[model samples]
Target chain A: MKLPAKAAQPNSENLPFFEGAEKGDLVLPRCDDCDFVIWFPREICPECGSQKVSWFKASGKGSIYSSTVTRRIPGGWSKVTPFVLAYVELDEGPRVMTNIVECDPEHVSIGDRVEAVFEEATNRDGESGPPLLRFRVTES
Target chain B: MSIKGKAFIAGVYEHPERHLPDRTLPQIHADVALGALADAGLSTSDVDAYYSAGDAPGFGVLSMVDYLGLNCHYVNDTETGGSSYLVHAQHAAAAIAAGHIDVALITLAGKPRTGGDAPGGSGRAGGAPEAPFESQWGMSVPGGYALAAQRHMYEFGTTSEQLAEVKVAASTHAQHNPHAFLQDVVTVDEVLESPMISDPLHRLDCCVITDGGGAMVIVSESVANRLTRHAIPILGTGSFVKSSQSGRIDLSHTGAVRSGPLAFAEAGVTPNDIDYVSVYDSFTITVLITLEDLGFCERGTGGQFVASGALRAPHGELPFNTDGGGLCNNHPANRGGMTKVIEAVRQLRNEAHTEVQVPDCELAVAHGTGGSLATRSASSTMVLGRSL
Candidate 1:
């Protein structure tokens, strides 16, 4: 099946809780009561349980915590199995799970270093979805 | 006066006749109920309450009593997703503690969701309101997780070899389980050499398709006294939902991060205290993430943990997946969650045999994930400390 379309909007306006990935920007929720970074980006901190929070971007960098290879593949996507999915510990102190492109899958391992690079996948006609964020190996 | 004392799981069972293709959802429920009652040595006449979780109607004992030839005073159809039934069990225990029912029969079954398009999927749930980011382009759960796998490779230098190692081990263990669907040990070479489905998550790394039904009977310590002699106590349990397909965040730490800790705190135990574990392996990566999330190892260290020779058979500390996980076993839709519970009970009951069986184990944990990672998910952990 096709991926969910909710993630394709470009404008993050008036939206309940979402923002597209921008260059050099790591978007997260900030507490209105007492500004604290919240990765899950909520109206309130799951911690203090506040209702007011805003989004801000930060540096995207982290180490690979763990990963898995999906061979059974997902729905309507048999051709895309045998892939590597991982959880990256962002240096900003928040971990973001994303795709690792442009590298040999065999070279990936836990604790290996990485840097976030935004790549836009266009579905032809110069029309594109949201800015897709991927990670690349970091120069140790 | 400790609240953490053992609680009895009065009855538990699967479908009686094994494969029943023509069986209706309600029919399966009746058979499962029969088996669980038999195990508990209590008839429907003894049941004070019944619980069900599914996208169906006429649940409760009303739809089932005809099969039981008896009636119940209490009934419930609380749907919490596939993981909901286990959640139902915890709720039943709470009700028992509160004197709501003498014996609560908690059962979960789905009408065999025939394959088609994934939910809220197939081009997105735009409501004229697609989430926007993934809709414009194609990004399913597989694609979302693909991003995570790739990031892991880029950051921690995780290799495909490490992932293949997990799949291989799961397959090896599954070989011993008669219920497993896919046999044949999958080699690391076969996994790596396979085509790239989503860059990092290959075809083998994904879960499978199959149909299954499971039911459980939980009773108050008082009701259980009159039920059966054999009882598996529920030492402790916990449940939580982190994100529900809401937004993108860490793909690693699940709701389990909170739920797992809660169960441990309630059980007065830790990961090391676990004797056997039936971790939900929806995909090979899930186990790796769970290892780190559940505190089995430090973050980013799960790859090394699996690669650790100490976990190898005949020497390893924890022997997981005695029945083969979703990766190797039958992942019949909602069955993915119940399998963990079933295995935990089986192992605790001295039922596991062949390859992955632990000699004589007590104290086990089974965990399952329901719902998507981007949004909300229910992660439930049950600590079964044998009291027999």
Candidate 2:
């Protein structure tokens, strides 16, 4: 029914993406030399091997490339059983792993249009961390 | 020069005990190593090269080599998750072909069943680039493969029943393996009736976790000639790493697309020439996608190919995983590649159980997939031929 409570532990390379999520925006790194949009946020462009990468606010809109309804949650998270996990192919041409929320888990299908939504989560130390990016089905 | 025919798998051994709480990790490694050495009619003193992966205990290759008292001139601890052993075999073959070393010893051991949590149970720690992006979500091992299965069904009309056929065939073959973790034959309906762990992948589609390990002894031409046991020649070997390509990932295929063709080309053999195959069956969907990638059938026809009982041992068009594979046999240390190579060696030697052994099997392929299919993964494939 909900994403796990674990928070993203941001580092120097990905700190910008997590900072953007805190501001309710989906930001991604793009290769300045080759125009490649890097996913999982890295320092160098995997395509051109260029270190000239910059961050920009994305459209936050995408379609589901693939999805799965997880009935058995590991790490003793069975209370939130049957949640939808998916890879959304953003309009900017990068796919991200996120949760599909705000709809029945069974209703989520491949190619369904979705929009990014951020949800706040608390870390193990009881500190509120950066919001996690999830997706919800939207009208085409 | 190619590694084809330069090295032979002179000996192989798979630990019979699925659960060994009394044994230590290094002990298990030593057990399989000695088992394989004895099979090859060689002593520990004959080993000059050592290969292992992340599953190796303590300091990896150094720990195992010293613990086993192996005086090696060359060593490799290449880590490709479950496919590490296959990759090791490929590397060993290349090393032998290059005349860098002879008598390479490869071993794998893990006690996931008696040792508690499977490897990588905890999320990646501290500054793993992908950890921040994907680890927070509920991405279980099955969930990753389910994503691929979901997309495959969406694009290719593959059904749950078709996927069940893989499990059915594995269970059927597993019935003949006394060391198999699950020996009961299952049906399509039974697999479908099993609880869904992740969508499109039922509990039955997953491999069994066990506490065991396996070992292999690959040697040079001269070493093989000196050994009394039947030597299965390593004809061709290829390994490739497939990543998400910075989010341009295609869930429909695997790294086998590159590795398989490379191996076949080097071996000068086609898929039709393979008398048996040992595919890493981490899950049923894994087999379906891999078969397609390996060019066994058209890309989307794997559903029909497998559902037709092509993977069943003894009488199928291409008997596969005659030792039950990771699906029903054993996934030692939560890694299945070691056993994949072990079984292929058995088939090439005509040493597999009579009920599941392929008759006059002369050629076989042993393939392994490491990491998750939906994310970054590694594929290793080897073509083996019966010794003349």
DockQ of each: 0.18, 0.86
Candidate 1 local lDDT, B1-388, one digit each (tens): 2225435786677542334467676666676777778888887787777776553335344666555565566666654455666777777777777777777776544434443223322222234332432233234555555555655556666677787777777787778766677777888889888676666767787666555566777877777666545677787788887753333355546788888888888888899888787777766677777777777777787788776632333236776776667777766434466667777787777777646667667788888766655445678888876772
| Per-residue lDDT of B332 in model 1 | 47
Model 2 pairs whose backbones collide: none
Q: Which ten-residue region of model 1 chain A has the weakest summed lDDT?
A: A1-10
In candidate 2, position B254 carries an lDDT of 97
Residue-level lDDT tens digits of model 1 in A5-58: 223344434233334363435566677877666654445565567878877666
Residue B335 lDDT in candidate 1: 46
How accurately is candidate 2 docked according to DockQ? 0.86
Which of the numbered candidates is closest to the native, going by highest lDDT? 2
In order, what lDDT does every prediction score?
A: 0.63, 0.90
